[model samples]
Target: MMIHGFHSSRQDFSFGPWKLTVAKMHVMKSANVEKLADELHMPSLLEMMFGDNVLRIQHVSGFGIEFNATYALKCVNNYPGVLKVACAGEWEESRTMGEHYKEIIRPYDWTYTTDYKGTLLGKALKLKVVPMTDHIDTEKLKAREQIKFFEEVLLFEDELHDHGVLSLTVKIRVMPSSFFLLLRFFLRIDGVLIRMNDTRLYHEADKTYMLIWAIQGLR
Candidate 1:
C-alpha cells in the first residue's frame, strides 16, 4: 500500500533480492527548526530558504547493497562554503545593517550549491568511481512498458529572497523488467546565473549491477 501528501507517506516494493522504499514527508516543524538552524551557520541563507523539507528513497538488496536517495534541506544547502560567482548581494533589498550584514554572508554560498550524490546506508560498500564505459539504456526507457510504480517529490525549494528560484526534486519508476530514477537540483538567478546537478540510476531485472550516472554544470 502507498500514501501521499502527509508527513509520513511511504511506499515499498520487493522483487527478487531487492527491496525499495520511498518516503515522502513535509518540512521540519518548530521542534526541529532549532536543529536545522544549528547546522546552518549563515543567517542570511537560512532566512531565505530555512532548509526544513525532507524526502528520501531507500534501496536494499539481500546481496549487501544498501543505498539511500535522499533529498534533505540541510544536506543540499551545505556546499561551496562560499559563492564562486559573487552573487551574494541578491538578498540585500530594502534592508540596512550597519556592520553585521555582510559579515554573516561573507563566507557563505547563498546559491545553495551541493555535490551530494546520495547516502550509503550502514553495512553498505563504499562506491568506486571507475571510468564510465557504459551508459543508461535510453532505448529501454522509450519502450512502452507497464510501469508498476512511479513517484516524484520535491525535496526542498527557496525563492532566494526574490532574486530567483532554487529547488531540488527526485523521481523513481519501477517497470516490469527494470527500475529507473532521476534526481535533480535546479537553480535560476533570473538573469545572473543558472546551474543544475543531476543523478540517474537504472537497474535491469537480469543484471547484477545497477548503473548510476551523475552530471553537474554551472553557467
Candidate 2:
C-alpha cells in the first residue's frame, strides 16, 4: 500500500516575536493501506498498519537554531480503537563559520504517554560544539567544547476526537533563548517526520575549483 499526496490547507499567524504556521492534511475517507504507505514513502505495507496517522512540527530561527518533533498514532492489530502513541525530536544550532561552528544535541529518545492530556516530559542531552581555529589552539580543537545547549519540555493534550476527526496538540519550550516559531503538519499514515536541510559551500586552499556531488544510485 502506498499514498501519493493529500488535500491540505495552511495558515500563518504572528504575535510579537512569535510566529505560527499550521498545515492540516485530510485523510481520504476511502484510503486503504496501500495508499497510505505510498503517501508516507514507506517501503513495506506491514509498517503502514502499525501507525494510522502522524503529526509533525518544526521550528527554525535565523540564528541557526533548528528543532523538529513528530508524533505517531499507532493501532494495535489494525484495530483503530486500540491505539498507542510515540514521540521524538532532534535539536541543533550552527553559526556562519560553516560546519566549524556547528553544535549538535544527541538524538532524542522516544517515549510513550498513557495520558494524552496533561503529559509532560523533560530531557537533557550532552551538547558538542566545534571550536574556532583562530581563537583556540589547533591542538585544542581535538577536545570540542561542551555546554548545556538547551532544556526541552514537551506537553501534549488531546484537542478533538469526533467521528472521522483526529487532532493532536503539542506544546514545547526551549530554554536559554526567547525565540518562538511554529510550523505544523498533519499526515495520514505514520512515521513521517518533517526535516529541513541547509547546505553551503566554503572556499578551500590552492584556488582550484571544487564541486561536491551527492549520488543517489539505486542498489
RMSD of 1: 5.0
Stretches > 4 Å off in candidate 1: 1-7, 44-87, 90-106, 124-132
Most lDDT-accurate candidate: 1
Candidate 2 global lDDT: 0.25
lDDT of 2 by residue, 17-53 (tens): 3333344443323346445534534321222232322
Candidate 1 accuracy as lDDT? 0.61
Clashing pairs in 2: 1-34, 2-34, 2-35, 2-37, 2-38, 3-35, 3-38, 3-39
Q: For each candidate, what is the lDDT?
A: 0.61, 0.25
C-alpha lDDT (0 to 100) for residue 87 of candidate 2: 24
